[model samples]
Structure formats: structure tokens, C-alpha cells
Target: MHAATTVSLIPVLSDNYVFVLHGGGSGAAVVDPAVAEPVIAWLEERGLELEAILHTHHHNDHIGGTPGLLQRWPQAAVIASAADRERIPLQTQGVQGGDRLTLLGRHLRVVEVPGHTRHHIAYVLEPQAEEAAELFCGDTLFAGGCGRLFEGTPEQMLSSLQSLSALGTSTRVWCAHEYTEGNLRWAAEREPGNSAIAERLAAVQQQRREGQPTIPSSIGVELATNLFVRAQDAAALRQLRGHKDLWRG
Candidate 1:
């Protein structure tokens, strides 16, 4: 079996996380880079070469760093949703759901998750040997919550979340933002008696107190504790989304 791909996080902007995927070699790929200076510094310091830039959506915060990174590594491929070419024009490779790609020697399958944006997409790195699977789900799904309905309906978000839920329990979810603490706090308020939410909130609180990222959450964990993922239907998800939009804590 091939060595498992290594994913490194570089926190940028206020709460966004840029993911760097690399294996045993110096070639690496970045996902949803909010900025480039830090990402460039990270790669240069490690002597890693940028081989590709994977965009989950065309949101500025998600794709703003592409131009700079392309300038630095002109040969790196820009992969994004084909339906969103107008917004994410730098994409050298336009892809859609079910498209397969081999980046940094790991196989990735695209999964359409259009809720945060009409053309939002995710990349699932198939598990190899003993390593767990990886999902780079931009702003669609969070640790204990989901992205707001910006350009899609509740039904679409529900469908998107359901599709992601089927990725298996062991898949490691790498969402773009650092909104876990707030998401869990709101979830605990909604499900006051849920021990899973309560316990996970406590653990996450400790992790935040230590300034640690609560990211790379497993699918099993989200299925158990995330209110959005556990919602029964579009109506339930809509209600939850509305409540979360107004929630201050």
C-alpha cells in the first residue's frame, strides 16, 4: 500500500484554514487558501513544491490566494467546479461531481455539495491501507453545524449533507472554518439532554482553551453530535438553519 497522504493546516484570515496535502515527496497541493503569503512561506520553509490548488467553491475567502500562489508556482494546476468557471476562472482543470483525480499520488473523487454556494464541491481522498479517508468539505459542513443557505435551498443543503454522510464513519472531515466551538455551544443549547453533544462540547472547549484546532473531525463524531447532519428532513434542517442564523451563543 502507498503511504498515506499528509495533510497540514495553515490558519489564515480570522478563522479560515488552508489545507496542504503532501505525501512522502516534496510536491504538495493546497485547498481553499484564503491568502498566499503564509501559504507560500509554509511551502518554501519546508522546501515543498506546489503541484495544485483545489477550490471547493468560488468564495473570495476560499479562492483569493490562487493568483498569488499561481504567480509563485506557475505550473500548479487549479482544480475547481466546472459549473463555476465564471467565478473561479483560474481553474486549469474544471471538474464536477464523480470526477476522479490523482493528486500528490493519492486518488480523489469529487462530491457535489451545493449549499453554501450553488456550485460548491468537495474532494474525498480514498483511504489507503490503514490510513483513514479524508474529506475536504469547504464551507458546506462544519464540525457541529453546516453552512448557511446562501445560494441554495434547505432541500439542497439537506441533500448535500446526506450525500456527505454516506462517505463512511471513519472519514476525516477537514472543513474550511474554525467554527466548531460556536456550533457545539448552539447544538448543546438545542439538545440540552444529549450527552454526546455535552461531552463533545466539553472536550472541544478544552481543546480551544489550549488554542488547538478542533478540525479534522471524523464522520462518526459529526453524525453523533452535529445537529445539521442529524436532521431528519428539509423542514427540520431549515428550522435548525434558521435558529442557528439567529443564535448568538
Candidate 2:
């Protein structure tokens, strides 16, 4: 059986999380380092060398630390969307949907999921033996919410979310932000009668109150609680997104 990959979460900024993926090797890769200091320190403390930086979009918070990380490990590969090369100029391995790459002896499939940004993508590392697959989804799909439409339409967002929702129920979803509590609260209010949303909101609130990270949410949990994922169509999704944008509580 293949060795399972190990993922570590490093929280940065106010709510963003930078995921470090290693496979019991000296070389490690990071997914969306919002800032460099924390990630660099984390890798160095473990005596691991940075090998690659995976970017899900061109957003500053997503790709902001690439230059800093690259400065420390000048040869580290910058993997990003080929279509967004102009915006993310640091990209060394510009890829798109349906592409596959190997990192730390593990295989990752690139899945283009544009909605929050025009060229946003996600990385899916399939399960090996007893390990569950992990999905490094940036701002596209949050724990209980989806990113607001910045450059794409509601239809595109819905399609992107639907594609992600189709993954294995046990797939671990590593979203970029810590918005679960707020998202679930909003979901509960949006669908006051939804027991799933209400129950999840309570649990997420408790997690936050205890200062615990409410991330790595599973596909099964999201499908059960995320209103946006449960949205039936583009029209329904559009309404939900609109309401979420104006929601303060």
C-alpha cells in the first residue's frame, strides 16, 4: 500500500489557512500561503525543504506569499493556472483542469473551479490505502458557504460547486477561510427549518468558542449542511449568494 500523505494547516491573516502537504519526505509543498513567515517557519522548524507552492487563484491572500517563499527556496515550483499567467507571473508550472502532477510521491489532479475568480482551480489528492482524499479548495468553496461572485456568474459558481460536491463523501475539504461559524449561522437563518443547518451552526459555534479550527470539513458534512451546495439551480444559488453578501450576522 502507498504511504498516506500528511497535511498540516497553518492559519494566517485573520482567517485564511495555508495547507502544507508532505509525505514523510524532506521535501514539502504548500497550498496557498497567505503569508510567508508562518509557513516558512513551520517548514524550517520541521527541517523540511519547500519544494512547490500550489496556488488556487491570483488573489493577494492566495498568492501573496509566493515571492517570499520562493526567496527562501528559490528553486521551489510555483504551480498555478496557465490562463492566469499574466496575473500570477510567478507561475512556473502553469496548468489547467484535467492535468495531473506528482508531489512528494503522491498524485494530484487539477480541477478548474472558477467562480470567485475567472481562473480559480482546486487540487484533489486521491486516497491511498487508509487515507481519505484531500481537496485543497481555495476561496471557491467554503465550509458552509461559497465565495461571492467577483468575476463569474451565479451559474458558473453553481456549476463549480456542484462539481466539487460530486467528490467522494469522505473527501476532506480544506477551504482557505475560517468562515464556518458565520456561514452556518447564515445558513440556519436562510433556511430556518433546516435541522442540518441549525445543528451544524451550533457545533461550529462551539468549535470557534473553544478556539479550535473548524476546517477540513468533509464532503458529506458540507452536502448535509451547506445551503449553497444544496442550492437546486443557478437561480436559487444567485439568491443565496446575494443574501449572503449583504448578511452581517
Candidate 3:
């Protein structure tokens, strides 16, 4: 039997999380590294060599660490969206929607999810023998809220979210930040009577009180409690996004 691929995280820059993927080997791939020092230290401590660096968008926090990481692993491939080359200029492998590539011996599908940024993309690592699928969605989809529409329209964001929603309920959503508690608190206010939201909020509150990270939320949980994901149309999404923008929570 093949060893299942493993995915882990390194928290950095306040709330940002950098993910590392490996399949029981000396090589690993990192996703949306906010900074390099911690990631490099994490990999070096584990005796793993960097094989690739995946970027989901061109935000400074998301791509800032690429140069530093490349300095350490000069030959490591930097994969990013072809359409956003002007912004993420250091990318070595430019890819688009539906494109497939192999990293750490696992297949990953590039999904064009442009809402947070015009050329933002997500990487969907396909499920292996006994491992569940993983979605490194950057800032597009959070635990209980979606990304603020910065460069794309409400319609585009709605479409982008719908595509991600179809990636299967079991897919593990590894978003880029540790914003679950705040997102869910806002969600509970938006949906006061929703038991799922209430239950998740209570559970998440306990987790936070214990100083734990509230991430790796599944699509199933989001479908049930994420008001953004449950928005029925563009107008609804627009209203929600507007409210979220002004929210101080």
C-alpha cells in the first residue's frame, strides 16, 4: 500500500498559515508561504528538502516569502497562475484552470478562483489511496467566511465559491489564515437561529479558549455554517460582503 500524503501548517505573520505537503519522503512542497524563515526552519528541522512552492495569489503576505525560499532551494519549482505573471513574476511554472501537475508524487488540479484577486487560483490535491483530498484555497475561502472581494465582482466571487463548493464535502479546506473564530462570530450574528452555526460557534469558542488553531474546516462544515457559502445569489453575496467589510469583529 502507498503511504498517504500528509499536510501540515506553520503559523506566521499574525494569522497567516503556510502549509507543507509531503508523502513520507525527504522532499516537501510548501503553499502560500507568508514568510520564509519559519518555513525554512520547519523543513530543515525535519530534514526535508523543498521541492516546490505553490502560490494562490499575489498578495504581499502570500508571495513575499517566495524569494527567500528560492534562495534556500534554488532549484525548487515556483508554481502560480499564468494570468497573474505581472504580479507574481517569480513563478517558474505558470498554470491555469483545469491544468494538472504532479508534486510529491501526488496529482494536483489548478482551479481558477478569482475573487480575492483577479488571477487568484487554488490547488486541489487529489485524494490518494487512503488520504482525503486537500484544498489549499489561499484567502478565497475561510472557515466561516469568504475572502473580501478586492479585485473581482460579486458574480465572479459567487461563481468561484460555487466551484469550490463542488470539490466534495469531505475535502479538507486548508485556507490561509486563522480567522475561524471571528468569521463564525460574524456568521452567528448573520444567522441567529441557525443551530449549526450556534453549535460550531460554541465548539470553536472552546477550541479558541484552549489556545488551539481553528482551521482545516471541511467543506461540509462550511456548507452548513458559512453564511457566505450559503448565499443563494450574487445580490445576497454582495450584501453579505458589504456588511462584512464594515464589521469591526
- Give the per-residue lDDT of model 1 (tens digit) for 1-249: 556689999999999999999988899999999899999999999999999999999999999999999999999999999999999999999999999999988899999999889999999999888888999999999999999999999999999999999999999999999999999999999999999999999999999999999999989999999999999999999999999999997
The sequence of per-residue lDDT tens digits that candidate 2 reaches over residues 162-181 is: 88999978999999999998
Better of 1 and 3 by TM-score: 1
- Which pairs of residues have clashing backbones in candidate 1? none
Candidate 3 pairs with clashing backbones: none
lDDT of each: 0.96, 0.93, 0.93
Q: Of 1 and 2, which scores higher on TM-score?
A: 1
Q: How close is candidate 1 to the true structure, as a TM-score?
A: 0.99
Q: Whose lDDT is higher: candidate 1's or candidate 3's? A: 1
Which candidate number would show the highest lDDT if scored against the true structure?
1
Where model 2 places Cα greater than 4 Å from the true spot, the runs are: none
Clashes of 3: 0
Worst 10 residues of 3 by lDDT: 1-10
Deviation (Å) of 178 in candidate 2: 0.4
- State the lDDT of candidate 3 residue by residue for 1-249, as single tens digits: 546788999999999999999877799999999899999999999999999999999999999999999999999999999999999999999999999999988899999999999999999999976667899999999999999899998999999999999999999999999999999888888888989999999999999899888889999999989998999999999999999999997
**Least lDDT summed over 10 consecutive residues: which range in candidate 1?**
1-10
Scored against the true structure, residue 26 in model 1 reaches a CA lDDT of 90
